[model samples]
Target: MSFEELPHQADVRVRVRAEDCNVLFAEAARAMFSIMYVTCDEGEIERRVSVTSDDMQSLLIDFLSELLFVSEVDRVVFSSFDVVITGTSLTATARGEPFNPAKHLGGMEVKGVSYSGLTITRDGEGFCSEILFDV
Candidate 1:
């Protein structure tokens, strides 16, 4: 699985590819948080996240949005994730550390995850999604 940043006029756009739903969500989270901070601190801090939605599209949005919220409130930056999706709900274990401005190189400030122009396509190979982050 992999994710890459795309050019957007007003926000950050990312294209993520994964072999399945689980990895797709995890990679998306990595991309989102990585955009905010390139690297976190030394100590590992674990956080469990759960999000529910009406559909796959909404599920993706909610999952990333929840991660963003958690990071903001806890004052941490996540580097890894183990995500599992059951039906329209997702449960994830996120690992990171407290934000250190002196060490972690910061990137753009992402405000929210956007639905406009978002698309997820699955063929015989795997899942590919384009997600827009409102910055």
Candidate 2:
């Protein structure tokens, strides 16, 4: 799995590619969190999250949005994700510790995930999606 940041006029945009949908979702999580804050490899804390949407695009947005809410409320940033997608429902295990100002600071402040320019497609290289995070 891999992700890269794309230049944008405002906000942050990323394109994540993975071997499958499950991994794609997980990478998306990593991409979003990485953009928001710098975190260590020590994912000592774990959190389980579940979300459902009517479609794939909405599912991705909702999943990240929920994670963003949790991060803000609990003062944490997840470093890794194990995600499973069954139709429109998603269940994930997010692993990371509480926010450490020294480690988790100095990154973009993501306001929210945006649907604009959001696209998911499958090719021989597996699955890929471009997500826009509202900053």
TM-score of each: 0.93, 0.95
Per-residue lDDT, model 1, residue 34, is 78
Steric clash pairs (candidate 1): none
Consecutive 10-residue window with the lowest summed lDDT within model 1: 34-43
Query: How many steric clashes between backbone atoms does each model show?
Result: 0, 0
Q: lDDT at 131 for candidate 1? A: 94
The Cα error of candidate 1 at residue 43, in Å, is 4.7
Lowest summed lDDT over 10 consecutive residues: which window, candidate 2?
35-44
Q: What clash pairs does model 2 have?
A: none
lDDT of each: 0.88, 0.89
Model 1, residue 3: what's the lDDT?
94
Q: List the candidate 1 regions with Cα displacement exceeding 4 Å.
A: 40-43
Give lDDT tens digits, candidate 2, residues 1-135.
399989999888999999999999999989988888855465688889999999999999999999998888988788888999999999999998888888777888889899999999995879999999998
lDDT digits (tens) for residues 1-135 of candidate 1:
399988988888999999998998888988898788877443589999998899999999998988888988998889889999999999999999898778776577889999998998994699989999987
